[model samples]
Target chain A: MKKEHVKIANREALIGVGLVIFNFVWWFAFAYGLGSKDPQEYTYVFGLPAWFFYSCVVGFIIMAVLVTIVVKKFFVAIPFDEEVEE
Target chain B: MNWESLIPLILFIIIIFCVGIWSGGYLKKSTSFAQDYFLGGRSLGGFVLAMTMTATYGSASSFIGGPGTAYNQGLGWVLLAMSQVATGYFVLMILGKKFAVVTRRYNALTMVDFLKQRYQSKWVVILSAVSIIIFLFSAMAAQWIGGARLIESLIGIEYTTALFIFAVSVLIYVTVGGFRAVALTDAIQGSVMFVGTLILLIAVIIAGGGIPNIIADLTAENPNLITPFGADGSLTPTYVSSFWILVGVGVVALPQIAIRAMSYKSSQSMHRAIIIGTIVVGVIMLNMHLIGVFARPILPGIEVGDRVMPLIALEVMPNWLAGIVLAAPMAAIMSTVDSLLLLVSSTIVKDVYLNYVKPTASDQRVKRLSITITAILGVIVFIMALNPPDLIIWLNLFAFGGLEAAFIWPIVLGLYWSKGNKYGALGSMVAGVGLYILSDSFFPQPFGLHSVVMPIVVSFFVYIAASLATQKKTV
Candidate 1:
């Protein structure tokens, strides 16, 4: 039998699902929630509506740094013999 | 008088032709004619594999059409297109080591080769061959038209004559040296694309007087230009989200790309590729689209969107520099055209001719047929390109959508889903492709989702249902 799928009931799974939901909410908020106003007119930085933009910048940096670290540590552990043998 | 502008283009072409010559020499070294011509002896390395994948996928659409659309749509298209940053990542992540090992084991030269081994069915092979030939013709024609249009813009040549020149140059080099020629040259073209995007984006931004100035100018022109909903609020949220499937994860299914997943030397290479490819793709996509929107303030009253990038580059950069910078899109167009030429040729030679016509054809005959077919396909695409589409990107994307719908479930499920058999595979492809065409025609953008969404769903069900009902031995 194929390996059983690990239950996606962890924090990472929740966060991933949450972020996707947030993406939809944010989009809907802009499309319908903001009453069709120009989004650039209000790039909130904190409690401000544009604060999300700053979050994206931060989120990108964080994701990049995290992925880099994970790759450096985790992916390197892949056995070299396993690579060529397969 | 303007030799500076022409100098870079001339130099670029010379370097590319020399690389083609070098690859041709390497092609001569291979003992078997078919092995050398089509698959490069199945021995591409880390850097070449990554570069080939990037250049083949980047295409004129990424540099030219993508940015043009971004220019028209504003920030939302940027968000949607950036999802494509994960393209190489997904292909490497999903199909990585296993795909390479299996194909090498099976001696599978083309995507159709994989299906042939898996199903051992001629119908699967024929269906795949038909889909690839038909859709790839549309895709190749789009690239040919883009190449001609770029040349036309630069030298003030008529589109038809420019197209004829472009076709001959690409066909000569690609036919002479097959995949190796294509891969080696892709490394060169990919670098050109990377640097070209940076320079042109910078020039367009500076010409627009910087980001804040551009934003202010956009607001003055129409506040909606700064919004995600497009100039007329037509880019619905659902429309934007569905693109995640079209250009993002769904790209894992594109044959041109999936073939590369199996072409690399090592998993280390795949790991390396994921990082380098993601960064390069991210930079190209973000900068190119931003340049498109950024061009708005500098070049007002631009009626034709596709011409926006070249016109803005010429306007902002000096003649010589603009010539060098403009080569980015030119590289994109040429790289895409060459890869498509080789792919369609292989589909004919390896997939159709060898499998059905002569399972034991001589290696010499195979080489000749492959070369002749590559040239013929190039000529046919040139004819299709003569009357260019209003926006070549749509044609390219339509081809993308259709191919993804046709192959994604079959490839993915075939690999992972043990229950997936030949019957299920055939059912899923037929259902997916049929609905994909039907939806695109009769009910485009159904329920605000992309035309591809429903077909993927329907095919997923078809695969499961057909497999369960058949209950043939699987995996």
Candidate 2:
């Protein structure tokens, strides 16, 4: 039971880390990859035309809130069951 | 003082005082003095919870210093500052039900109480107390300086005298009513923050003519100002990416923010706070920073960054409205200082004095010590503020970095990992502090990464390895 709980938590933690990494990379790709403007030219993504460190915060905030909901609702306790071992 | 300009500020003070008196009544009548004073008797509703969280988190940095940096750095700093929009959501989400449930179970008034009960070690209690007292004092001193400077600029008073008056005002309200006053005033101030940012942004746009005109002016002034790398290209990719660790993820460790996570009454309140707080923080941060850049075209040359907001407001709006609008930052600084002062005082009064000095101290004595220490802390911080820096943004950031470096691993790892025992917490803290200071003094950014990166990495290994090794020994 404890192992299951740890598994779920570890999964969530990894997903959390992954999302931010993805967003940062998306920003770099959008700014410099296909959308690579010259150093002198202004960088813009769509109408915004920016490297998305700040706007990506909106995505992060939503993810954080959703994680809290998931932790509160779906992430149920399995309780400690230590007697039966692998 | 100009009566016209001072009227809104006067009204703000009067309203805050009334709330303090009312909350003081509630506090006096409560069964648990510490609970009432420290955590609002754990009865805060969703709206109050959301507002208080927003106000507490939005410090002088958010309102004044952040925008000031934005003014100089142009829109890039805005991009960077918005990374903090997730702060409120992160706090509520990360330290939600577990922290609240565990804190209540432990009857913890402060973060140290939670740590003490969790670790059952006197060392954890002592170190947490010392860190809170030392680092929070520096943070509090920065807010005090910001407040004094704001008042000085607004009312045309000498900075020292203004500091004295502002010091007395905050100390008196907080000392008398404690967390209740802070929370209630936070609601008022938080609304002011949202409205003030809105009004100021609109006024700035009009002052600059419009976004297109503002862009043209900015391009004419310096084209690089609009880019991601900042004017001098100091904001490198590595440095910008590393800041995510500082202001974004690692903010979870700040005691001031961490304690907020433990304050609300219910999970529903926490959930509501997450939603409401994100929207508000996003609006405030985006608009304030945009105003910083927008103000550049409007008010061409301002030497000091801190004065940007005050000068912009006065330049565009009426002096009277400027004072009232400017009260938002004042509110932000005061709310932050009040919370930090109380947190530090509790670190001394509850964590140290009650735990070690006299475990059997009566309620009256605890209350007395809390108030006295808070006042003393306020006075000390005021003295520290007399010689203010030109831009307080750096001072505030240093304090932020110091606190995050000092507390992040111990608090976060302590919560999740069961193997995280006392030795691990100690070693992690030592590693974090040691590396942080070393990097701070010698090379703030090693290989273009921020100073905090190396320390955090070192601390993580110290925490995990030390905990694993210590666990075997204990077994």
User: B95-187 in candidate 2: lDDT tens per residue?
Assistant: 555566557667887888887887787887787788677777777877787788888888899988999988988888888888878888888
Off by over 4 Å in 2: A1-36, A39-86, B60-64, B387-398
Instruction: Provide i-RMS per model in Å.
Output: 6.7, 5.8
- State residue B168's C-alpha deviation in candidate 2, in Å: 1.5
lDDT of 1 by residue, B381-428 (tens): 787787655544454556878888889888877766667778888999
lDDT of each: 0.73, 0.74
lDDT of 2 by residue, A1-86 (tens): 25565565455445445544654555445433422344345544432345443244345455456645554665433322124447
DockQ computed for model 1 against the true two-chain complex using alpha carbons: 0.16
What C-alpha lDDT, on a 0 to 100 scale, does residue B32 get in candidate 1? Answer: 82
Candidate 2 docks with a DockQ of 0.16
Error of 2 at B42 (Å): 1.9
